[model samples]
Target: MNITTPTELSWIILLQSLIPSYKKRAERDTSVPDAANKARKFAQRYGEILESLKIDPTCQGGPLDIILLCKLREQVLREVGFKDIFKKVKEEENEKAISLFDNVVRLNDTIEDEGKRLESLVRGMFAGNVFDLGSAQLAEVFSREGMSFSATCQNLVPRPWVIDDLDTFQLKWTNKSWKKVIIFVDNSGADIILGILPFARELLRRGSQVVLAANDLPSINDVTYSELIEIISKLKDEEGCIMGVSTSNLSVANSGNDLPVIDLKRVSQEVAYLANDADLVILEGMGRGIETNLYAQFKCDSLNIGMVKHVEVAQFLGSRMYDCVFKYVEV
Candidate 1:
C-alpha cells in the first residue's frame, strides 16, 4: 500500500507549522541533561538541515516528505541524547489507567446493545487518545491540570466527525468476525491500557487473533514494544487472563519505528509477517492515523482512528481541534 501526505497538503507549510511546537517540547523535556542548551542546539541544527532541504531538494539524499521530516526531527533528538523524555509521565499515567481498567471494561460489558457498546469502545479510544503530549497546546494543558478519561469521552466534539466511517464499520463489526486483527497502537498510559486494551480484549473474546504493533523505541509519549509487554503482564491474572478473557490469542510485535509517525514499508520483518494474514488493520493515534496515513489503503479492512490535536491537521480536515476521525475502508 502506498502512503503519502495528502495531495492538498503543502509539505513546507506543514513542516513550518509543526517545528515550533516540537522545538518547545524538546526544550521542555527535562529528561535530557542540560535540556535547554541541548534543545536550542537541536533546534538550530534541525532548522539548518531543513533550510538545506528547501534550497536543494535532493540534499537529504532521500525524499524530503512528511515522514522523512518527522524522522529527521527524531534523529536530531537522539543525537542530542534525549531518549524517552516522557518516561516518568508514561509510568505515572500507566499506573492510574491500569487501576481504572477493570471498571472501564465492566462498563462496556454492561452495555446491552452491540452497536452501542462498539460506539462506546470507539469513544473510549478517542478519549484515551487525548492524553497525547506531543501537541504543544495539549502538553501545556495536561501539565497544568490533569485530564479525566470519562470527562473527555463525554466532551468529544459532537458526531459527524471529519471523516466519520464508524457507522459502516459498526455494520461489519456486527455481521462478521475478522480472523485476525492487527492494531498499530499509539501512546502510553490511557491510550494503550484504557483505550486500546479493552477494545483488543473484545476482539479476542470474539475469537480473533490480535497482534498489537508498537514502536521498537520511544517517540514522544508513544509506548514501546517492551513496555507494552510489561503492561500486559501486569494486567493479566494468575490464570493468564485479562479481566477474565484469555490472552492466548494476543501477541505484540515491534514496528521497527522510532518516530510517532510510521512508514508501513519500513516496519519490522516480524510485523510484516504477522500482518500477512490480518483481515483487519487499525492505526490508532493522531500521528500514525490522522497526520500521516489517513488515506493509506490496505489489502484487507483498515481503520484509521484519531483525534485532531494540531491546528494544522484540524484545518486540513476542516474540522475543529479534538474532532475525531474514524476512516474505515474495506477492500
Candidate 2:
C-alpha cells in the first residue's frame, strides 16, 4: 500500500527525522544497557545509509520504502552488540501463544461447518496479528496477559477492513486444493504459534506440504529460523515428532537475508526452491505484505494478510490504524 504524504519510513526521513523515540524504544526493547548511547550510534549509521542511498537527507532521494530501513537497523543493532535484543521477548510471546493453541483448536473443532471453521481460523490468524512486536504501539495493546484469543476475535468488526479480499479468497479456496504452501511469517509468538501455524496445521490435515520461511537473522521479534525450530520442537508430544510436522508435511526455511522487508524477486535459494513448487503463497504481517508486497504480482495464487500499524500509512492507503487487510490476488 502507498503512503504518499511522505513518511519517515523512508531513508531520507529516517536521516532527517533521526528515527523518533529511538531512545525510548531502544531502552525498552534492546538488551544494551546503554540504549541511549546506542540510539545515537544507530542514528549516525542510519545517516551513512542515507548518504549511500544518494539522498541529501534534507531534500529528495530515491523512492520512499524502496530501500529497506530494517536492513540498516539490523546492521546498526549488530554493531552495538545487540544482535538478539528481542530474544527474550520472542520466547515469552511464543510460550504465551502456545498455551492458547489447544483452546483455539478446540473451539474450531466444535464447529460442524467447514466454511465456518475456516473463517474462524482466518480470524484467529488476524487476532494473533495484534500481538505484533513490530510496532511498539501495538505491542503494548495486544501482548498483555489475559488477553484471550477469542476476546480479540470478538473485537474484530468484519468487513469494511482496510482491504477485504475474503470473498475472492474464499471463492478460490473452495474451488482449488493446494499440494504445497509457503507461508512468509511475520512476528514470532502469537503471530506464528497462534496465527500462521494453525493454518498450516489445517493444511496438513487436508494433505498439503507446508514450509515456513522465516528470517535467517532477527528482525524485530520476527522468529529466526533457529528460534522457529525451538518453538516447533516444543509442540512434539513425548514422541520425538509433532503429529502434523512429520510425514515431511511441515518444514521451515531461512529467508537467507534477515531484513524485515522482502523483495521476493531476490529471495534466498532455500526460499526460491520451496516457493518454486508451492501452489499457494501467504505473506503475513505488516512489513512483508503492507510495506513491501501490497501490490506485488505473484506467479501463482497469493494471500496478503496483515494489520496496518501506523495510522498515517493506513490513512494514506484509505484506512485507519489497526485496520486489517486480507488481499487475495490470483495470477
Candidate 3:
C-alpha cells in the first residue's frame, strides 16, 4: 500500500527511539566483570577469531568505548566455551595491573591484524550485531527521510516516524464464497490510523465488514475510540470524506452525543457473530504493555478456531523479534 500521510511517518519515529536506548544499555552493561568474563571466555574458545584479529589494550579511546571493547572480548571468550580461568576483570588479584597487561597485548595484536579490527571482530562474534539492525536495517523500510539508524543506535538518538508511512492501510480477508473483507486494527499510531482508514473505506466499498480491535484507553501511541474519532476528524478535515467507517463488533458506538465512546470490550456473542458470519477475520492488538493478541488467542482458541498457523514476517530494529501474521485453519 502507498503510505502517503505524515501521520503514518510518526509511527516509524516512535519505534526508532527504542533502538538507541537498548544499544546504550547493551554497551554500558558490557563493562561488568561477571558478564565480561563470560564474554571473554566465549571469545577465547573461538581461538581462530582472536588469533586472526590480534586485539590490543593500549588503543586510545573513551573509557566507555574501551569498556565496550572489553565486553566484546569477554563475549568472544564465552562463545567458544572456555570455562577455566575465565575471571572477572575487577575480581582478579592486581586488577588494574592485569587489565593493563591484557590491554597491551590486545592492542599490539590488534594493530598487527588491521583487517580484523575490533569493531569487525565484535560484529563477527554476534553474526548479526544489534546496532547494525536498528539503524540501516529499520530505516530502509520505515524512514524514507535521511534518518541515520546506525548513528542513532550508537549515540542513543531518538527520531519519530513521518505520517506518510501510515496513510494507506490494506486489509485482506476472504469468505468461503469470496464475498467479504475484514480489517483488524491494533495500535493507534499514525501509520495504523492512516492505514486502517483507507482499508476500512475499501472494505465498505466491497460490502465487507471492517473491525478495529483496540484497548479502551490510550496507552502510548495505541488509540481509543475517541482517538480514532480524532483521526477521523483530521482525515475528514483534510479529505472531506467519512464514507466507510466500521460498525462491526470492534467498531466504536456512541451511547450519547456528549461523550463519543463505546464499551472498550465487545461481548462474546458479538465477536462470535462476526467470526461465524465473516468470510475472513482480521484481528488487531493493543500496542503498549502486554499485547492484545494474547487475549485474542485465548478467545480464538475457545471458539475452536482449530490449528493456528503462525507466519513470521520481518525482523525490525536489529531486534530478535519476529513480526507475525497468523492463520487459523479449521479442520
Candidate 4:
C-alpha cells in the first residue's frame, strides 16, 4: 500500500519553493484572535524548524520531505490556535456551489456524446480545483474577486496538457466500467460540489459504487469527511437522488489525513478497507494528485487529475501554472 514518488522530484527544491507560500498563508490566517500577531509567531517557529533541518539535516528527526514539512507547519499552526483558517470561506463557497449544482449538471447532461460529456466533466474538475486557497496567488485572487465555475470551465488551458491522457482515458471510458471507484477528493466549494460530485454521479449512473475519501481534519480548504457528508445530504432529495441520479451507491470515508499533501501508506483503516475492492482509484487536486503522489502505482487502474496550482509543481512538471494533469494508467 506504499505510494511511489517520481524519481525526478527533489524534496529539497520543492520544499524550499513551497514553504514560503505556506508561511504567507499562515501569516494571513484570520481564524484566531490577534490573528496576524499569532500567525507571525507560528511562522517564526515553523521557519526555525525548517532552518534547523537545513543546518543539520539529521535534526529533523524524521524524513526531510514535503510530508514532514507540511506536518511541521500544521503542528505550528495548531500550537498557535489557528484552527480551520479557511472555514468561513469554505462554508460560503460551498453554499454558492450548491446553488449552482443543478445548472452545472444540466449543462453536462446536454452534451449528447458520452465522450464529450466526460471531457467536460473532467474540465469542470480542473476548473473547480482553482478554488484552492492553499495557493498563495489563487487565494489572493479569490479574496479579491470570487471565482465563477462556468467561467473557469470555459477558460481551462487548451488541450495537450502537461500530462495529457484524456484521449486514452476516454477510450477506456467507452470500453469499460469499473465496479468501484475511490476518489481522494480535495478542496471545498466548487471543487467538490460542482466538479467531483457530478463526475461521481456519472460513475453512480454507470452502476459503480463510489467512495469519496476526504481529509479527517481540515487542511487548507480541503473538505473534511463530515463536511462532505453534510454536502451530500443537502444535495440529495428525500428520495435519495442527486439531480435524478440515485446516491445509494455513493459513500464517504475519512482519509485520516490532515495535510493537503497525503501519504497513502498512512490512510485511515476505513478508506483502506473501502479501497480493497475498488477497480479504479483517483487522486484529485494538486496536493494529492500532483505534488505527493503523481507517480504512485496501484494494483487497479488509476487516474491522477488536477490543476498545477503551484509554481514549484509547474516547474517540476515543465508546465505552466494552472495547466491541467490528466494522467491515467490501466493495470
Candidate 5:
C-alpha cells in the first residue's frame, strides 16, 4: 500500500490497462440468439462510461488507485442499466467450475503424502487465479476448458513466486487447527469453486468452522453473495463431497462491499459476528489481498493469496505477471 510513484494512481494508466478487455467484452456470451445484441448494447454503455470519465476536465491528472477505479466501474455499470454485467458470465463460470470440481478434488486426494496433498491444494488456489477479470483476455483466448483447465494451470508452476511462505503455513497448520476460518473469496470461475472451496473444506476436515466472505454486490468478476449461494447450494446436493464437510458447517457473509476492493472497516453484521472467533483469515485475489489489504492488520493469523495479473500491480509489488504470492502473518 506504499505510494512509490504518482503513476501508480494515474487514471489514464489504469484505464489503458482495462481497454483491451473492455473493447471485446472478454468472455462474453454470444451463444444465445439475441446475446450478441445484448453484449453490444452493454459494451456501448460501458464505453460511454469510460468516455465520460476521460472527458471529465475535473478529473484530469488525478492519482488513480484500484479501489477508486473499482468504485467508479460499479457506479457506471449501475447507471448503465446493468448492475451485474457479468451475471451470465458468472453463472457459466460457476457451472463449469462446479462440473470439474470433483476431478480437481480427486487429484488432491490421490496424493498420498499429507504435506504434499495440502501443498497441491494451495497451488490450486494460485492456479485458479487465472480466472481474474483483468486477465479475462487470457481466459477468453484460452477458452474455459472445464476439467482440462488443470493442464493449463500447470504453466503457472515453475515460475518464481513473489511471496511464498507455504512451508511456514504448513509447519503451523498441518498438525494444528483453528476454531474458525474466514475465506475471503475472489472471482467466479475455478478460482472459487476449485480453489478456495477445497481449501475451506480441508479446514473443515480439521474441525474448523468456515465463513465464506464475499461481495455484497457485484464488481468485475468477483463472486457476490447471491452467486456464492448458488454454488454452495449445488455442492450441498452432491453425494460424498470432498472431505465430507457438511454444508451446515459452512456460512456465507457479505463483506458490505459492491466493488472488488474490500474495505474491512465496514463488514456485514454476519461477517463481523463470525469473524470474532476467526483465528485464520485467508484473503484471496489481488484486489482484496494485495491492492487494498496488502498491509491490513488484524488481531489474528492472516494469509494473503494473489496472482499479480496487471502490469502496474506487478511493478508495484516488484513481481512479474502471473506471479503468485502466499504471504502469512500472525499477530
Candidate 6:
C-alpha cells in the first residue's frame, strides 16, 4: 500500500479547494455562488501560467513571497475587471502602449481643475464611492496655513486615494509588541510616501515590530533596504527616527533608534527569527498595480491576510493602473 506523501497531499488539497463548491458565510444563509467558481478558474489559470514559467507556486519562493504574490494576483483580477470566471481581461488586452501613454498624459492635464475635474475623473474611473470618506476639500485647507503649494497640491491630489488616514497612519508600537509588519512597497512616489510614512510612525509609536518588505532599489523612489541602512546608521535619537525594518538586498547599520533593513530574499528566515516575540505584522502595498498584484499573491500563500481594496486609489490613478487595489470594492 502506498501512502500519499505530504507534498502530494498538499497538491490534492489545493486542487480540491480550487474546485467550485457552495459557500456560506458566518451569520448568513447557505448558498452556492459564483465567487468560488471564479476563484477556481483564477487558480487554474494562475496555475497554468506558473507551470509554464516552471515555477511551483507552493515552493518557488518563501511563503511570505508567495502570499504577497497571491495578494497581487487578486488586485490584478480586480483591476482587469475579472472578478468572475465569465469575464476576465488580461493586461495584453490594453497593450496599446502608445495610446495608454497618451491617456496618461491627458490625465495629468485634466487634473488642472483640481476640485471638480479631478474629482469627476476619479469618480468616473473608480466609481463615486471611491471617495466616500469625502473629497480632498473635505478637510481643512492646509495651503492657507503657510504650507508649501507643492505639499498642499500633493496632499489634495493624491495619486492613489488610499485615504486621508493613510496619508497619516503612523503609530508608535512601544506597548504593542508586534513581531513584524510587512510593507508591500511600490514605486517611490507621492502616494507611496504618503501611505507608508504614517503607518511606520504609528507602528513605531505602538512598539510593534515592523518590517518594510519592498523590492530592491532603484525601481521605486520609495525607501529601499539599502537606503534605509544608511539612514539608520546616522540616526541619533528616537524623536524623528521612527523604527521599523526594511527588506531588500543589503545590510543596514542599526544604531537602536532607527529602523533596520533586511534583504527581501531572506525574509522568511528573518521573520521566523523575529516572530518568536512580536505583536503584529503590517504589510505595506506598493502604490502600483503590478507590485500590488505581486504582493496580493504573496500574502495569500504566506499570511492568509485579506488585502483591503482601496477603491479611491484606482479613482486617483484615473485608470492608468486601474486594478492597483482600490478598484475592486463596490461604490
| Model 1 lDDT at residue 299 | 95
User: For every model shown, what is its TM-score relative to the native structure?
Assistant: 0.91, 0.85, 0.32, 0.92, 0.84, 0.31
Query: Candidate 5 regions off by >4 Å?
Result: 1-5, 8-11, 23-64, 139-148, 238-243
98-179 in candidate 1: lDDT tens per residue? Answer: 9999999999999999899999999999999998887767777878998999999899999999899999999999999999
Q: Candidates' lDDT values, in order?
A: 0.87, 0.73, 0.31, 0.87, 0.74, 0.31
Off by over 4 Å in 1: 1-33, 54-57
Cand. 1 TM to true fold: 0.91
Go through the candidates in order and give the clash count of each.
0, 0, 44, 0, 1, 61
Model 4, span 253-281: residue lDDT tens: 99999999999999999999999989999
Mark the 10 consecutive residues where model 2 has the least summed lDDT.
Answer: 55-64
C-alpha lDDT of candidate 3 relative to the true structure: 0.31
Q: Which candidate model has the greater TM-score, 2 or 4?
A: 4
Quick one: ranking by TM-score, best first?
4, 1, 2, 5, 3, 6
Candidate 2's C-alpha runs over 4 A off are 1-25, 28-36, 43-66, 142-147, 238-247
Give the least accurate 10-residue stretch of model 6, judged by summed lDDT.
21-30
- Writing each residue's lDDT as its tens digit, candidate 6 over 108-220 gives 34454434433333232222112111112211221123223123333333345433222122122112234344444332222223234333444444444455544443220
lDDT by residue for model 3 (1-331), tens: 2222332223223333433322232333434556444444443343333232233222223222212232333344334333222122112212222223323223424444323332222212111111121223432333233222223223321112211111111111222222333333333332243234444554454455455444343222234455555555554423454432333323542211110111224433444455554455444321211122222433221111111111111222222232222233221
Query: Model 5: what TM-score?
Result: 0.84
How good is model 4 by TM-score? 0.92
Instruction: Give per-residue CA lDDT, model 2, range 28-64, as digits (tens).
Output: 5546677777777776766666655443332333344
Residue 106 in candidate 5 has what lDDT?
78
Candidate RMSDs in order: 3.5, 4.1, 24.0, 3.8, 4.2, 18.2
Which TM-score value belongs to model 3? 0.32
* Runs off by more than 4 Å, candidate 3: 1-184, 236-279, 285-331
